[model samples]
Each structure stands twice: as structure tokens, then as C-alpha cells.
Target chain A: MGTKRTLEVELSTTGLSPDGKPQRVPLVVGGDGGAVALEAPPAMEPEFEGEHMLINIGPQHPATHGVLRLVLELDGETVVRCIPHVGYLHCGFEKIGEYRQYNQIVPWTDREDYLNSIGNNCAFALGAERIFGIEITERCKVLRVIAMELSRIASHLVWLGTTCIDIGAFTPFLWSFQERENIYNLLEGWVGARLTTSATRVGGMAADIPDKWLEGLQGFIRTFPKTIDECERMLTKNAIWVGRTVGLGVMSPVEAVNYGLSGPMVRASGVAYDVRKDFPYLDYETYDFDVPVGSAGDVYDRFLVRVEEMRQSIRILDQAVKRLPDGPVNVDDVRIILPPKSKATSEMESMIHHFKNVMEGPRPPAGECYVAVESPKGEKGYYMVSDGTSKPSRWRIRPPSFVNLSAIPKMVEGHLLSDVIAINASIDIVMGEIDR
Target chain B: MSPSFTIVHPGTGSNATPVTPKNVPVSGGPVSPTAEAVGAQFPGVISRTVVSRGETTIIVDGARVHDVILWLHDDAQQSYDYLSDVTAVEHRDLSLPLEVVWHLRSLRYRRFIRVKVLIAKGAPLEVPSVMDIYKGADWLERECYDMFGVKFAGHPDLRRILMWEQYKEGFPLRKDFPLRGRFSRSEQLKNALAANPEARYSMEELSIADAFEELPLDMRRRLSEGEKVGE
Candidate 1:
């Protein structure tokens, strides 16, 4: 183990004296739980009031989206450089996923992107299922699509409401939450959990949809367009919203793809790269919906892209609901999915099968697959490497927010301080996904 | 509704099959061609190529990974532009202890190709950083270093990104590392915080501690004692 020692070093961050001259200072760096004492290296220069000032934003700021910290180097009103410091909410999800069973990892995926739990579940389930070489029933596939689309709408509502609040609009927040709540009301009935709805199991859903759940969704989809229209009236052409966000956070098409930005972030850059469309999964190819694209990769373009995406999601939901079938929701595999309640109660073999499946878990074939779902955020990918055992050898989550958030510094380097908040919102990051 | 979309429910589980044409991924997709192209381009560099479960993974020599990737980026016909993700895997039983997996997507071809590098088992688990080819690899490479203790030779600002500045414990993602960490700094941190009221607050760390405490204590103790939980 390393021992504690005192080391005095050159000071760059210590401001000039009242007379305006360089001053040397000794800073002590230590352990036993205390603030980091720093003496800037000779290569580094301290920020002076007249020249530049260093500002720390969030580890707890509303605009940051979560426990994200940014060390912004500000030269007057313009940002000279922006360094984002994340991992404040790191829970070692990858490590934990390696230890859990295939079915057990579903709930953990839900927490990665809390707003789009079902979407995250799909990515993991599909990845695991691919390795297992199992194609779920047609009904199960349609249900998976329905759950994913609902998650897209719910996550987008939160993004829309919060981004409005971030850019100094209040009324839309109320309107957006109302729409989000209706989805929650339906999901809670179907999935049992409101926020972290581990909605899907490895083969199919944990439980079949409740009676009349589709009716609620049908009503919501019919009315959600009106809410979108109302939201558009409030801010779509409003001078304040346009002035703040229109030209802010511009990322060129090549830059967007180069930086590995996906979802609407890349779409706003005129690249229509949606996992649902490009890399179709879970019967997305069967559904007819357009991938919305924006020519200008700006903050305003991102907003427009999201709104258009919501409309597309509604269209998918309409088709999926219309085609909802009467069949087994969960795969009827005794080794994979649990036995039906009717079978379990009557048949001894069915009960034993249920007991074995629950106590142990599905031991998929030894292989690996990287399955991605076009989640609300972007391409939510789960790269799973499974040994010939119940537990996965490696479970890697390529969270869209984590990768998308990496491009923020480039987007905000020369931008004004106020625009940083608006730009950050347009990226639509969820810290849970980013930190995981 | 299209008649093709309606899958005939033949049976359940092992016997069940999609009535419609199976949603089997397109095989001769651009990935297979690119895999062939890479093998042909760098004959010695590529050791093995496995196209399984609709994903193409090409294993290359750890020594020449950077050269192969550079070729992929610069080569006009086989130009792989998007570096989707960079991750590493650990297998204690294997001769090569670590394998750094890089997923690259060629947007022009609309396909994904996985390139991997195997690092020999040693103290310095290191690889070449591809930050120059893909700017997004900056944080991802740092994250690999932080989690797996795999040092990237040319990574700038290679500090611990996820863990605290003062963290000195072993890399948590290693195969030998216990799920319940061997060291318990909870008591020490609690005492330190009590003594210094003005100490910085990390709700994240505290929540993590809370989660660790929820696991079965006896099992965790045995796990920390280097005992395997189960087969």
C-alpha cells in the first residue's frame, strides 16, 4: 500500500497578488478522506480574473441532467475549453452483470436507462436470446415492439418537458408530464413497476399484458398528438426558444458520425441511422414508419427530430396495437420461460420445471452477440459474452448517453455559458445510462 | 396486416419455429465481405475470424492491432469509419489473460466488424490507444484502464475516470476480483467523515455502500476470503 507523504509543488492556479504579479504557493496533497490539494504543473497556467476564470458546474446542477460535473475554462463569456467529469453515479454495472444469470440481468438493464426500461430490457433480452438461438413467438415479438415504442414515448416526454424547463419555459413541463403519466398508468398495470419496469424476460415478457391495457394505450396515442401540437404552439416558433437553441450546439454530419453520436443526435446531422430502421430488430422491419432526419445538426434540429420521432413512434404503436395477437406472451419453453400457472397447479412435471427454471436459470450456449435496440435515446447495445453456464462471462452495455455525452466538449468549446445548458438538454442524456 | 408477418405457432420452446420466413440476419451482409477483405489485406496480422450469431469477430495479433485498425480507417475501399465501442474481456484460464475488443462500423457499407487484441497475462496489461483514429475513444479507453487496469500506451490524460482520484484498490473488473470487494473502507470513511464535518459529500459512494451491505454478509465474507461461491 502507498504511504502518505507531504510534497510541495509549483502553483499555477493560485491567482496573482493585489499588485498583479505571479505568486508561488505550497499545496499539501493527502488522504484519510479530504479535499484534493492541487499545485498545477509548470505547463498549466492558473485562471486570472481579467484573463480567464475556471468554473465547476454540477456534480449537482439541474441542467447537467445528473451527477455530471464539468470543469469549464471560461475566457470572459465564451468557453475556452470544457472538460466533463462523469462516473459520479458509477455502480460497476458491467461487473455486476457478469455475476448475474441471464434472466437476472433484466432488472439491472432497466436501471441503466430508467426512463426507457423496456427498451433497455429489449436490448439485453434480444442479445441473450440470440446467443441462445431462440426466436420468440410472433405475439411476443409484437408485444416487445409495443413495449419498446411505449418506452420511447415515455422517455421522449421527459426529455421534452425537462429540456423546456432547462431553456426557461415552464408551461410545457406540466403538459409533458401529463402525457408521460398516462403512459406510466398503463405500464404500471402491465409491467408492475412504474420507473424501473423490468418489463421483458429473456425469452418474452415477465407477464402477459393486463386486460384493457391496449385500450389505455389506444386512448393515449390518439390524444398524444394533440399534446405534441400544444407543445409546438408553446415553443416551436417562439422567439425566445429559437434564439436560445436554433444555432446552438452545432455538430456537422461527419463530426456526428466520427464522434459516434447516434439516435436523433446523428439524425439531426442529416444521417438517418436508426437501429430500428438500419439494423432492424424485434420485427421493426415489418412495421411501416419513417426515420425522421434533420439537415442542420443544431440544438433546434435535435428538438424537431425528437418531436418528429414521437409522431413516428405513435405510428408504430398504431400498427403494433392493431396487430396484437392472441397467443402465448412468454415463450412456452419449459427450460427457458416458466411454465403456465394452469400447468404448474395441475401437472407435477410442470411444477418441477418451474421450480428448476426459477431456482437455477437459462444456461444459454457458449457464445457472444452484440444486440442493439433503437431506444428513445439512441442505439442501446448490449454486448454479452456467455460461457456455457447460467451466468454471463461478460456483460457490456454500450449506453447511447455515455457515448453521446462524450461529444459535448466539442459542441460547447466556443459557445457562450448560457447556451451550454440548452445544448446539454438537446443531447437528452440520462446519467444512469451514462454512468453505468 | 401482411400474411407473412403471422407466424404459425407450431409448438412451444425447442419445437417452436416462426411460421413466416425466419428473422435470420442477412449472412452475406457487408461484414462477411469486409472480414474476407481484412484477412486478405493483412494475412499475418489476422489470426482467426469467427462469423457467428450474425456478428463478425476477427482476432488479430495484439502487437499489430494499431496497424490493422489504422489500415481499416485509412484504406479507401475497406474504410471503417465509426469506432462503435472499445471493450476488453478477462479470462483467467486462458493463456492470454485479456482481450481488447473493438467494434468498428463502416457507415458506407452499413455493417459492423469486430477487431480484437489479446494481451498476455502480466502486470502491465497494456494495448495501443486508437484515440487518433476515433476521437470518441478518449473516454472509452480511459474507462477500460479504470475498470480492467489495462493501460493504453499512448492515451493522454490516462487518469482514473470512474473511480475517485485517490482510489488505490485493485481493478474491480478483473476475473479474480471478488464481487464483494476484499477491502471494506466503510468504517474508515464513516470515522473520517465524523472527524471532518466539512468533508465533501459523495451520495453516489454512500449509495454503493448501501447496496454492498444488502448482499448476504456471510457469503460476502467467504467470497472476500477467496472462496468460490458456486460452480
Candidate 2:
């Protein structure tokens, strides 16, 4: 009996039992030593059944998307519990914002959500303008709309590319990043910086779009969707992609709202809540676009919603380019908007205004305002409190990724270890925003 | 206002499509009607109602804020189902009270309201946690605690989130703390160099492997003395 058992029995770690014990498979040796018979694994090794294992995935790992560290407790390959540790990149942007002027904080905003720096700059500028009681010109509003949409496209592209790499696809990563580079070239032409483009001021944009910048934008708008189509063709129906993403990290509508999810994260759970549509800032309400929502609230649904959002953003960019009115890019107020460099060099009053604006900064009334925008990740908001000074008393960033990442423990329960990577990628977190 | 444009406000639902607000006054616009409703239902709970830059802010009694928030979340008409943020503000003036703010959004009605609690200087910097109402408050509350040293009484795990658990420097956001940090660069570097790599694994993780007992005695003593990894 012992010789037969030793010859016929083989253990395989393929799956887990309902009770969380590691399931095994046994291969029966051929009766006449000619063929092997598959049989149910025999239960043994009782001591090993209850011993859970602990594993750590990041802090320095590439799959985490950032410096996020996840400690998962496992029963065989099934995740029993997951603990996430963040803030390895904490630089205290909020603390720093308290010491800097409202306009000075724009660059810091660029650093927080580095992937969406221009969008953050627009958000901060909008919040500051509200506090300063300066309504921007129509042209500035249109430019900000363009800036935000372009930033959203860049950010969503990064999410798509990195998530593909995480889920064992390589081609889409290259294609998405190539398009992202085109966006960077456009940004560099406008702001002279790519990753941290501080292209916004309190009253208006830092500079108007250069000659033929619109042509570059038109080129991108015309050709960018093809890349999205190509990536979709590769992964949307791929069996391996579907198997890895579908039905993983599911959150019901009610649960998604309770978790304070926004952007594609909440929209994927069938909630039609969009800050642009609901809260309506930067004239987003006037633009015609659909808010993509998903029914399943799974990773695959999130991917679909994000892809659809890129198309919707293109629609918005098209409308903005067509309707962009001609006017002064900056407000007429000398208190906030600096004088033109050419005028500053010649006119004494303009030079004085420029000196004062740069040195003292614009002082907002003693008040507070909370301005929220539909960032690519979610509802990004800036809460500014002023005490009748150039510097803000308190500057708080309502980072969407931070709140969205909080739901990971609930999402990863009962999932396999490999699914954790997919779920984390689905969160679309930037450590700069989370740790700030 | 033109009849073609539908005004966005509470109780209007989907029939009233929101439009981008133009010329929002710096102060004194229409306040959120929920402020009065909250004030009427929870008498003496709201201390002050302020409408600044077109957003309504209600300062509630610190002890009763949890009840107000729970009611605001559970009520059908005032369903502020989303907890957008949880943050605290320390004023530059030393005499002012610390303000703990909660930003709530009602997706169905398209309304946003800010609820604030003022903790007087020298008073216990603590408030009841709303984690029960919004599970998303877990990290927000923890982050508020980590940055401001404000305690959320009922939070299941109110630990330092961004900063390490054993970080001895005082709350960085406190007005009194220097911008450069509490310690000099050399001292901070010395402390970082002295930290043991094995100590970074939290006791919760170590307990599963039963590896705590095998650690060096001094390290065990440090961990046992309430020094642990991040939350």
C-alpha cells in the first residue's frame, strides 16, 4: 500500500478550499504503468492547513504603481486580509502651502499630482480666484478647460499604460505612452515644462497658447483616438485580460458612495456623479459630453469607463476649440495679474504694478472657499482659507486618490494574491497626492 | 434670471440641470437650505452659519457633530451620501480655536455643505469619529489625526498614516512646529541611520509568523513599548 501510494500520489497547489485550506491534486499512476489517472486530492498534513502566511508587496516595487506598501495575510494563495501603508512620499504640501502665497502654491500643486500637474494648477488657480473675488475672462476659462482636459488625457493614458504592464500586457503600454509623449510636447510648447507644468496663474493662464499651438492640439485630437482604438483592440476582448480583470474588486453603488469614491472609480460602480456635471466648474456644465457609467463595478468595468471617458474628453476638447472666444487672457485687475513684460519695461506704472504683484502677491479677502473639479482620478478639490493676507491661512487638498485607496482592504478580501495587483492598479493612485 | 436656464439647488433633482456659476460673490449668496433644516432638527447643535464664496459652512458643536453628520447621511431628503474630505485647519493666530472640517456632497440633489467643529485652545483635541457612517473616513480620520494630533474617539484604528508609527517629532501641521521639522538635519539623519530594518515589519505582521520572540531583546522592548509600524 505504501509503495503504491508513493508512486501514484502527487500534490499540486492549484486552488483553495471554501474553508481556505490549500487544495491539492493527485495524479494516479497508470494501472499497468501506461497512463495516469486524475483523482481528487487526498487530505493530509493537518498541521499545514491552519498556518497562514504573510507577504509584503511594495514600498519599492514597480507593480504597486508608486511607493504604496501592502502587507497581505494569506491562506494558501487566497488573501485573507490586506493592510496598506502609505506616506513614504509625504512632503507636507499642505504645510508648505500655508507658508506660500496663493499664486506661489501653484507650482507645489504641480508636484502633488505630478501626472495631472496642469489640472492641479487650474484647480488651485480657480480656488484662489474665487477667494480673491476675480472672475476670469472668457478666454482664460476656455484655456483652463483645454488645460484640464489635456491633463486628464495625459493622466488616464498613464493609468492605462501602467495598468497594462501590471496585468501582463506590454504592447498597449508602449502605444499609450507614445501618445502621452505627444501631450507632453504640446505642454512643453505652451509652458516650457512637461511633467510639472505650472501653466496657470490666479487670474488667468501663465501664457496664451503659442502660434500654431492649436494646430498641434488639432493634430493630437485627430490622431489620439486611433491609439485608444488600437489598445482597446488588443486588450478589450483578450481572454487573458478578461480573466484577470472581470469581476475583480467589485463595489456596489451604495458601497462605492460610502467609500467616497469619485471619477472613474465611482462611475464604474454605476454612479453617475461627476463634479463637472454636478458641481459644474470651469464652464464644464455648458459642454456637451456623456458621463460614462458601468454596471458591474469591477476592474473590467473601470477600464471600460476610463476608455469611454477619454473619448468624452476629446468631445469636450473639440467643443472648446470651436467656441474659444477672443479676449484678454488675463483679467484687467492689476492687483493679481502682472503687467505685460513689454509694457513693464517701458511704462513706469506698469513696472510698479509688476514689482508689487511679484513681491507682495495678490491679497484675497478674509474668507474661505472650497473649489472642486473633476480630475482624471476623481473629485479633486482645494479648500483655501484666507485671513486678508497674501498667504493662505490653511490650504487643504482633497485628494481623490487618497480616499479611493482607502477601500482596498474591502476590495481585496477573498481574492487571489495576483488579483491584488490588478485591484491596486485599478485605484489609479499617485503617491504624491496620497502622501501630500 | 432667464427661464431657459434652470437654477441648480437642493431638491431640484435631475429636472434642473446644473450650469456653471458665474460671478459668485465673495460673500453673501444663497446659503444651503440644509443648514436651516439641520439647525431646526438639531436645536443648539449649530453655533454659526456662514455663506462664503457661494459655499455654505455650518459650525456645529463638537460633541454633537457626529449626531448631525449621521442624521445628514441617513436622512432621505438631505442625503449627503458622500464624504468628500476630512481635514483640520490651525489658524496662524494663537488665540483662535482649531477648526475640524467635513465636506459633504449630495449627489442626488447636487448640493455641498461644509460642517465644522471648533475645538477651543487647550481643550481636548478630539471628536467622535464618523467612520460608522462613511467607511471612507478611515484614512481621512487617520490622516487628520496624524497631521493635527486630533483624536477621533470611535475610530477603529486611529494611527499615524503618512508618518511612521514611531515618528517622535510632533505633529508637523501644528502652527508651532517649525517648517524645517523639530530636529536638525544631522540628528534626523542619525535617527534614520540607527533604525533597524527588521523593525519596519509591524507587530501585527510579525505575530502571524511568531517572529517577535526571536527578535533582539532591545528591539522587542522598543516594539512592546508601543513603537510599531504604520497603520
Go through the candidates in order and give each one's C-alpha lDDT.
0.77, 0.86
DockQ of every model listed? 0.16, 0.37
First chain TM-score, candidate 1: 0.88
Pick by DockQ: which candidate is best? Answer: 2
* lDDT at residue B69 of model 2 (Cα atoms): 97
DockQ, cand. 1: 0.16
Model 1, backbone clash pairs (residues 3+ apart or across chains), number: 0
In terms of lDDT, the poorest run of 10 residues in model 1 chain A is A1-10
**How many clashes show up per model?**
0, 0
Q: TM-scores across all candidates?
A: 0.82, 0.89
Compose the digit string of candidate 2's lDDT tens values, residues B1-231: 111111122334547778887888999989899999998999999999999999999999998999999999989889889999999999999899999999998877888999999999999999999999999999999999999999999999888998887778889999999999989999987876555332477767766655666555776788788775534
CAPRI tier for the interface of model 1:
incorrect
Docking class of 2: acceptable
